[model samples]
Target: MFNLDQAISAWRRQLAAGGIKTPEVLDELESHLRDDVEQQVRSGTSEEQAFNSATQQIGQTNVLKVEFNKVGLAKWWQLPIKLKGMLIRILGREQPFPFPDLNTFTPRGLQTLELAREEAPRLGHDFIGTEHVLLGLMKSEDGIVLKVLRKAGVDNSAIKAEIERFVGVGPVHEANMAIPYTPRARKALHLAAREANALNHVHISTGHIFLGLLLENEGVAGHVLRNLGVQTETTREAILKDLAGS
Candidate 1:
């Protein structure tokens, strides 16, 4: 006699042993497992079969851990309710931002973030700034930012030249040293989330990031764009149009 509750508990322990240790994350994963098992059982699957299927669908423990880590799972959920509420309000949201448990970044969006981190070091900067993010967006060949720039007849090389000129090389740091985001860069990320929410998009992309840079118009990226003849409103409209058409 296979017991579902015991089986699920054992499965959770396996996940925990495999490094999916955060309580909230474990609870969330268990909830999903239960839902899947319940649905499969309703479809006449045997209890054992349903449990096995659910575990497989939930994915391997190591893979799930990697996915959760990518989204900063622990920090995001550990935020104080009041602070979370304040962030929601700041993003112009009446409700909490959607899918708090899941990563909102598309593949390209994640790549852009990684590239931005790389760009900061390549420029010998100790911190990631909006300028690095701008370079990241441009460097992402599949990003919508490049599409918009091309449509606007703005040269990518020109933008790179401007960023390099404005943000000259700084003292080099150790290659293994962890770089942090500047205040404006952090704000830009928040704005990117807001842009995704406004567009009813579950996943944030390079286009949303570009909009974030535009919204943070006091940043170095904003100044570079302005100097190169990219109007905030017009660029915004163009991005919106492109997204809409796509």
Candidate 2:
């Protein structure tokens, strides 16, 4: 008695009410829901039962709507499309710039900052993106990158306290500050710059930082990226391919 099509239609309406307005993103979400419902139906559940089960397993649509809204501006994992919009407002033109703050950066993040300075103006942007923030932390002398490094496996405060004992200081820099870069780090910065430019994206996003780290491909930074389940070559290639088609 459960009408699968009816249920999906209702869910789509729910998403729209919650401000998930992009048709493309909605289509992908719908496809996922349909796949879930079909799997439940194939497992011998009645249509109604399958519908109910699939919907429940998918969690509340309202909550998902909230998550989608938070994705671009608030989420640390990915830069929201608002960045592109902001750039458009600034330039008074239609152009896409990546958001920079979303980088899951380590020490190598500083390189991203240098790259941004070199590239942001070229992209005709006045401000940097979240990806740049991530890179700034990594390259900053502010001891943030070190904190992230030590805190990777355990409590961050504990690592800082231990470091203070050796350095006789709270931390080398404040949490929101960026550190200076060395020649080697500068070279890493250039690589990130080149990669961003090659992508033709006006601003950088966290995804770009992932690519930068992969291009660096060394030491602790690379190891952390591997653990994070980032497939550098594959993701880079996929982004490039998508850009090409677009």
Model 2 lDDT at residue 115: 56
How would you encode candidate 1's per-residue C-alpha lDDT over 89-117 as one tens digit per residue? 23332222232222778888888878887
Provide TM-scores for the models: 0.57, 0.35
Top-scoring candidate (lDDT) = 1
| Alpha-carbon RMSD, candidate 2 | 17.4
Candidate 2 deviant stretches above 4 angstroms:
73-211, 214-246
Taking all chains together, the TM-score of candidate 1 against the true structure is: 0.57
State the lDDT of candidate 2 residue by residue for 96-214, as single tens digits: 33323434233334464655454333323333433333334444454433343433442334422332232122112222233222222233445555666786765443344445555
Q: What local distance difference test score does each model get?
A: 0.72, 0.46
Ten residues in a row with the worst lDDT in model 1?
77-86
